[model samples]
Target: MSIWWSLHLRREAASVPLARRLLLGTMETAGVDPDISFDLSVALSEACANAVEHGGDERAGVSSSAEYRVTAYLDGETCRIEVTDSGPGFPVVRGRRGALRSVHSTAEDGRGLGLIEQLADHVHYRNRPGRGAVVSFDKILKWREGALLKVS
Candidate 1:
């Protein structure tokens, strides 16, 4: 069976943990491997932190009512999560391979994207310029029993 959920949260520090806990509970209830759940939970925290820090009205100094969104989808074999924010989009950077790179190890900030990329099997970022930014990632899920059996 496939499981999915979505949450619309205020852009605040407290909201980050709330999202993580919900994800954790979902995975645990679904019998997802602990290691996989931990990794995804950490990555989810990072994504939420980025949205709280960079994707909010605080940067613009106009609206105190800022919020973010988190969505998760879990099939029998794969888990996908998306975190979106209603603030200025992320800055664009290109890696040596000409791919969009949002992380800078040399810098003191913006390390979450790097960590997210390392943890997830697939990572994608979408920026709506003046509207918002979205960070989406997916990871292969494993059951404690054995390899995931394909439904079909």
Candidate 2:
């Protein structure tokens, strides 16, 4: 059996807490252990936070009219999570993907995706059908002595 769940989040910082809680509850009902659930929560929170903070600027009215969608599911041994926004998709700078994994604390922004990378086993970004981008990640969950161990 597989557990699938999703939620629509408005573009705001407050939605981070709600997303974490929702995912936590979903994972619990799906029989995910507490530690694995917490790790997933952190990864999801960072993904959503990146969408809200860097995907577009609220003060600039860029994504003010848009919304974000978050989805998660467990298929066999892998836990999948996706964060999609209505704003125009983020750009991929040439030859910068590797740098993002190690560079942080720079004067400018761009570390949110890096955080997601550190936490998630496999992460990718793509454009949705209509507009905006979807960042998704999958982490392998293993049963270690009958408890869930996040084995990215």
Candidate 3:
């Protein structure tokens, strides 16, 4: 079965893990290989964290009205993932970060794009029709028994 998933959530700390867990669980049930599922989940988590950190106003003590839109699909041997945010569009340089910059580094506050660049076969960012932007990535799945890889 083809693996496809999507989630929309407010810009809240609690919602981030909840969304990721739900999507990961769905991907697992959809027969997605574990490694692919894990990578996609990591990418989505970073995207959501960026949105919440930069676009949300959590100081209000209530959930931020901001929303994140995420979609992932596997067609044929290609897997595509998209994460969109309803906040102010990110800066142009935001997508230019290279993989050499590690997100896990203690000094880096913006490493989501870098991680995406390193993990995905292809990555792009563009403004959505509204007041937001969408980041998309693609990779070719090998369809191994335990992991997704590029087909020969």
Q: Candidate 1 on 81-149: residue-level lDDT in tens?
A: 999987767777777876566766878787888899999999999787677889999999887653343
The ten-residue window of minimal lDDT in model 1 covers 143-152
- TM-score, each model? 0.88, 0.76, 0.70
Cα lDDT tens digits, model 3, 1-152, are 46677877777677778767876776655556678768877877877777676654344334434677778787667778787776555554432553222334454675777787777788877765435667788876544454332233
Q: Count the backbone clashes (under 3 Å) in each candidate.
A: 0, 0, 1
Mind sharing the TM-score for model 1? 0.88
Compared with the true structure, the alpha-carbon lDDT of candidate 2 equals 0.73
Against the hidden true structure, what lDDT does model 3 obtain? Answer: 0.66
Question: Arrange candidates by lDDT, highest first: which order?
Answer: 1, 2, 3
Model 2 segments beyond 4 Å from truth? 56-64, 96-107, 128-130, 144-152
Model 1: residues with Cα > 4 Å off, grouped in runs: 59-65, 96-99, 146-152
Error of 1 at 106 (Å): 1.6
Candidate number achieving the greatest lDDT relative to the actual structure: 1
What is the descending TM-score order?
Answer: 1, 2, 3
Global lDDT of each model? Answer: 0.86, 0.73, 0.66
